[model samples]
Target: MEQHHPSLRSEALALLRSGVTNREVAEKLGVPRGTVGWWLHEDRKARGVVVAERPHNCPRCLSLPINRPAYAYLLGLYLGDGHIVAKGKQNHLSIYCCDGWPGLIDDAEDTMRKVLTGTNTGRRAKIGCTEVKSYSKHWTCLFPQHGPGMKHQRRIELSDWQQEIADGFPWELVRGLIHSDGCRFTNWTTRMVGGKRKRYEYPRYYFTNKSDDIRKIFTDTLDRLGVEWRTLARGSDPYNISIARRPSVALMDAHIGPKY
Candidate 1:
């Protein structure tokens, strides 16, 4: 015998819209209880509504609808502490690196633009080595010119600039820049490839008992540079510093110099 009929379907839909229990509606319509559930499911599917089995919100998932900033923040957290491995010898971590602020040239003019008018919503605000090269050779040619015939001078110059930039950003920033997400200032070290020696020091910056001093130092530098920055302290432990602009080797060398 055919169970489903137009009258039963209409009654089921009406009962569902009226908030009647599926079992009640099934009994009233002389159909199995699952029939009501299947109808509701099909209705939702037809309307393109995804009803998650567990109906709770994940902040990380919800953040995407708001803005890219929220999305990026969620992404950073995900990259930082989201996953784990079981019995794997190698620890895999990923970090973000912007080669250059694609559209923004790394000249005084572009810097001025950034200072005056901030970046757009989707655009990333940072000076990359690639963008730096296009505008001026100041960063690329910091050292004394050696020979008359400089065949591959720019490439060599760029490598030097890269190293300088890498060194300038407090080792913490350097670590973050190189390894986009996983690298932390505390308890993280850089070692030489295939060697036992540690190439760079961990906990690059010192934090004293005085909280104001740390805030002052960070704020003063940012104010002088006309840049925006934020620092979050992890329960009186090491703090994480995030800046609007990526550290430039040329600028760092000029500002802080070798002593810093």
Candidate 2:
């Protein structure tokens, strides 16, 4: 049998424990990041290393209470496949609509109304609706109707009266609603595709949540909903978003009805 490179593996584990990034360790070891991860995994099995411990401080700002996952979820919504058309200086709101989305105009209006109203309590209300005025802004919906290069239809912006309704919501509720709305919108896009063609089209659906408040609400809601979520590392590269396929039907049965 060939001699095992235990020393190299130990060195890799040491590097990981020393706060060196996997990429850096991989570079030093002349191997892929996956290789580093594999080495660490093997060492964990052999040495009985437990790596699931939580940190005392936050991961994003690293202040306290460990709320980084929330920030990451929000950032993901901002960076993922979406459009941020010019709205005003130092201000732009992002919007994303998928091809498989049913009743595009209606959904957009529903989202707008929810963000403006601040509650998901009504019989016909969608989750993430909020009565927060500070967060509401003029947003346009662009969807393909007949074919390519179609004229983009503009949905009516929130009116002054609607703004009055939104202004009534508390600040915390407003933040929660916006974050939850982003999650709902992103989840909808992910589930929109169907059939054999879906294999090729499914992965394109994405959302980024760049705000601290947005991230916290999303992860907290996910935890409350008992859904699995992961935080991504910072980089210029894109991250994959995957939802558990087994839970889809059950989740839908719990909230969505035939009318939805």
Candidate 3:
């Protein structure tokens, strides 16, 4: 290991303690990124800093203005396929997105960051999906719907403030839900036209979830937006909401069409 000047080490530590990334500090100080990381590690070890969570700018805790639209969208995603784990010094919120749709994955991570400013995000690859995660102790504070069991097995309801945000940005909420757990596809049938068979196609949207409360929340937002939907049963259980009406599909296409 090459030795650096004492003054350079002090400057690097100062920049790092002020929230600069290891790469940024290294470039600024003309040091290797690995050396910057090693310095930070030693400094924390010597100071007994067991946890190095960055400073959190939780809107709820700081009484700061929230990006309500982003929050609403993130809330919908949470209800569809997100979870928060806050146990024994481990705290984070994770939203799973299919790997094929890189755009959705990026959107999910971006929205999480927007909702909880100053939080750090990471990605974990599953068999066929990517988990976009953000770390912060206050995730539970924002998502009271999190509980001890699966979402379907527990009651899920938004707080009054969350409700207000959802009401104000219903389309974003619907978009988020669809982006996470819903899809838009075309259905086709054959019709005789001028003695020739012609295939006719129409587009419809479906939002599926096992949690009845979550489905109701999605439908309630649709009701407010005047987008008609019907519940459908999957294997003898109601698990899908279908939006096929022409006018409603048009409305959906205008605001929250197929996931990109």
- Candidate number of the best lDDT: 3
How does each model score on lDDT? Answer: 0.37, 0.38, 0.91
Worst 10 residues of 3 by lDDT: 51-60
Q: For residues 1-260, what per-residue lDDT tens digits would candidate 2 score against the true structure?
A: 23338787778889988988889998997767888877777767888877763322212233223222222222222222223344432223333433333343244334434332331211222343212111222222111111222112222222343223323322222222333332332222323345333322221112244434334444454455554555554585223232334464245224321212
Instruction: Return the TM-score for each candidate structure.
Output: 0.21, 0.26, 0.80
Clashes, model 2: 22
Candidate 2: worst-modelled 10 consecutive residues by lDDT? 141-150
Collision pairs in model 1: 95-180, 95-181, 96-180, 100-128
Order the candidates by lDDT, highest first — what do you get? 3, 2, 1
Clashes per prediction? 4, 22, 0
| Candidate 2 ranges beyond 4 A from true positions | 1-96, 99-102, 110-207, 232-241, 245-249, 252-260
Q: What's the candidate order when arranged by decreasing TM-score?
A: 3, 2, 1
Which runs in model 1 stand beyond 4 Å of their true positions? 55-260
Q: Relative to the unseen true structure, what is the C-alpha lDDT of residue 82 in candidate 3, on a scale of 0 to 100? A: 96
